[model samples]
Target: MPQSINCRVGCPESEAPNTETRAWSESRKMEAMPSRCLFLLFLSTCKLSPEVVAEVQESSDGPGAQEPMRLTDVQAAMEFIAAAEVAVIGFFQDSEVPAVSLIHSVVQNFQDVSFGISTASEVLAHYNITGNTISLFRLVDNKQLDLKGEDFESMDATKLSRFIESNNLRLVTEYNAITAIGLFNSMIPIHLLLIMNKASSEFEENLHRFQEAAKLFPGRILFILVDSGVKQNEKAISFFKLKMAELPALAIYQTLDDKWDTLPITEVLVEQVQNFCDGFLKGKGLRQNNEAKEKTSKVEL
Candidate 1:
């Protein structure tokens, strides 16, 4: 949190309610720096790399417009604003000229998004009839800008910090057999496995399955995907004694008990994948036969 922007009594402030704050669109308050300077400011405050800045600057003006959803009225805008931690508001300078700035303000009742205009109530005031459109950018926790004040000019490098510090990501990274052994060592106790050729459809299907699973389980289970076609994978293939033809197979690795199981499903559909995952949780789907194990085993990486 930063010092509130002092403005008209009803002005929108960033963050908490009752904080005396002004609108970022208050041109009198937010001094316009050169494009290069503003670019550098974004680099420092937003923790953007030089390459990203260069890429942004390379664009003629800016990226193509994908207009954000606009709030309908004051009631809707107030509701939208109240729910957000941080929001960016876009305002039109005239009929065509548009500009935006970040704000942390508690608001209530509007349409699809929270909105504010320079007015009497100091709350969401509908400007739709006036042809003034505003867009909101909801900035959540994690890598985010934490400036010292509501004024954009006040942002300094020292104030920027990461909200979350732990490495909780669950995406499956590319790996070979040797690297796989070292990788999963630190993973959470329970993990699922998907073995498929990187160039094949099975790889994509499995990837989607794991990513979707993340929405529900989050860090509870790890999804590791391995490319079974590579030379590095051959060692794992031999370790599991899998034949050449059975390339794509699914398995689950339980680190707590040091066990692995071959999933029963031959096809990688969403429902079947979920059921296989459920069965693995129950400790039911282990390799049943030596012949079946030899065909399905593609040691997880």
Candidate 2:
């Protein structure tokens, strides 16, 4: 007959392994039991079906995983602009509809994004009355970023003047009420255009030097020479036209203004053009390489 057995509720019976064996066995069992309990807990907590988990695991860990493609510099900016195209420019109107307009815009001068719309548009009225809020989305291939910001009713004239000077933007006329009001109410994008005057041989030579430097790093230079003089000689105009035609890549130009306009050729425009050109070159190189690779692959296949 078997010996009478007495085991406490939490204690293992005598058939359990002896001393060291029992401890090891108990430890292993404890480990296994917890794992099993945890697995059950995981199953219960997950909302995903077993099939979905299996599919994801197979895709992520198996041969199906693929590296994501990166966007080239130009492509990234273009993608951003394309995505932001339909962005709303919101303006407050006391009248019937709180006016909102969708405008097409471009990211000009690298640093500031610009949009071209008529100054006399309804948006101007709204902006004049109660300021404005603009919202847009930026996307580069798979990446996305949203932009939302407000426009001030009036920017300081002195500040604007400084900005104009810094950016090389030549104002058509001197600081006047009309110009001030136009700037105050205008929703001109942050970008400014630089117009350089090529009145002298020295100026032309400097322009050429700048162009050469830019070519050393293509897509890294922008020079627009505007001939703004009362007695503009045909030789000078012809020379400018020829130069512009020759150096199509370099942003060279002559101004058409009879009165000397300084605002058109601001430093801000110069900086922006430089940055844009650099990005453009980089993007172009990437695209060309990609094309070459595709061609090679096709030939091999």
Candidate 3:
């Protein structure tokens, strides 16, 4: 038997988890901070299956818009999270709980994240969530976060929002409208953007190797993936002065002072990526300044 969750008015829901991501394990380390979000990933829209594409389209079209989507069963939850870039799922047995209401309020403010709720007995047990919990899932690292326990219902709106924002990051967060909010709000001030063209033959190899490199620095740096072929991502690519010819590339950006460094690499071995990250951390990166605010304005979407 699973623990029962009770929810009242003004509570929230969460998103599903993709079963495809079995390579990683659970992480429970807690660190607190706030700053701007930065990281990018490029993925081909064509790579998504027809149903997955449809789910993304429906979400973009605002099918549930302001309200959290209801997860009737475990399969529904799985599909929802599998297709989302960032998702939160609330596993609760009661709709009258205060924490649920609080999360619901936060959901309305963060339009970029997908929120879903599951009261199903199997759904709660599947995630191993005892009591009422908010599980945040991110595609970047295939990581699932349990926001907190015991005192979750007592968290105020501001604290709840900040907690979600700061932890919103993952190992290799993708660049997009919804994800951009989390990327910029993260407390990590420095960013490493892996700009790639998914259509290129080299994309998969680089992605896998770079992910291992990203795992090396958790709180110290933000790793992002950006695809040059994605039209909407052109803003980030061009802002970094990355052209298709110059990618797949890796660039580091410091948000506090708006400085950046870009490097085009032919080989993406873990060691090379690790060296890149190490160089920037050791103050060896040739970071330059540009009109970042004016140029990145379009990323607010």
Q: lDDT of each prediction vs. the true structure?
A: 0.37, 0.25, 0.61
lDDT value, candidate 1, whole model: 0.37
In terms of TM-score, how similar is model 2 to the real structure?
0.18
Task: Tell me the tens digit of each residue's lDDT in model 1 across 20-74.
Answer: 1321112111222111111110101234445433332332123311222243445
Q: lDDT (0-100) at residue 162 of candidate 1?
A: 13
Highest lDDT against the true fold, candidate: 3
lDDT of 2 by residue, 1-301 (tens): 0111111211122122222222212322332232121000000112444543443343334532221112123323233223221111222332222222222111112122222222223533322322332222111111111112221222233322322222221112111212222121112211111223455445555454444443333211223233433122223222222222222222222111111101112223334445554554344222221133343221110
Residue runs of model 3 more than 4 Å from their true location after superposition? 1-168, 291-301
Order of quality (TM-score) = 3, 1, 2
Winner of 1 and 3 under TM-score: 3
Model 3 C-alpha lDDT per residue in residues 1-301, reported as the tens digit of each score? 1122222212221211111221001000011122112233322222446664465446445655466777877767777776776677777878777767777788766666777888888888787877777777765544465655644666677766755564465567776544454555445667788888888887888888888887777566778887677776665666566557677788887766556777787768888878877887777855454454344322122
Off by over 4 Å in 2: 1-115, 118-151, 154-158, 168-202, 218-301
Clashes of 2: 28
Best by TM-score: 3
Ranking, lDDT, top scorer first: 3, 1, 2
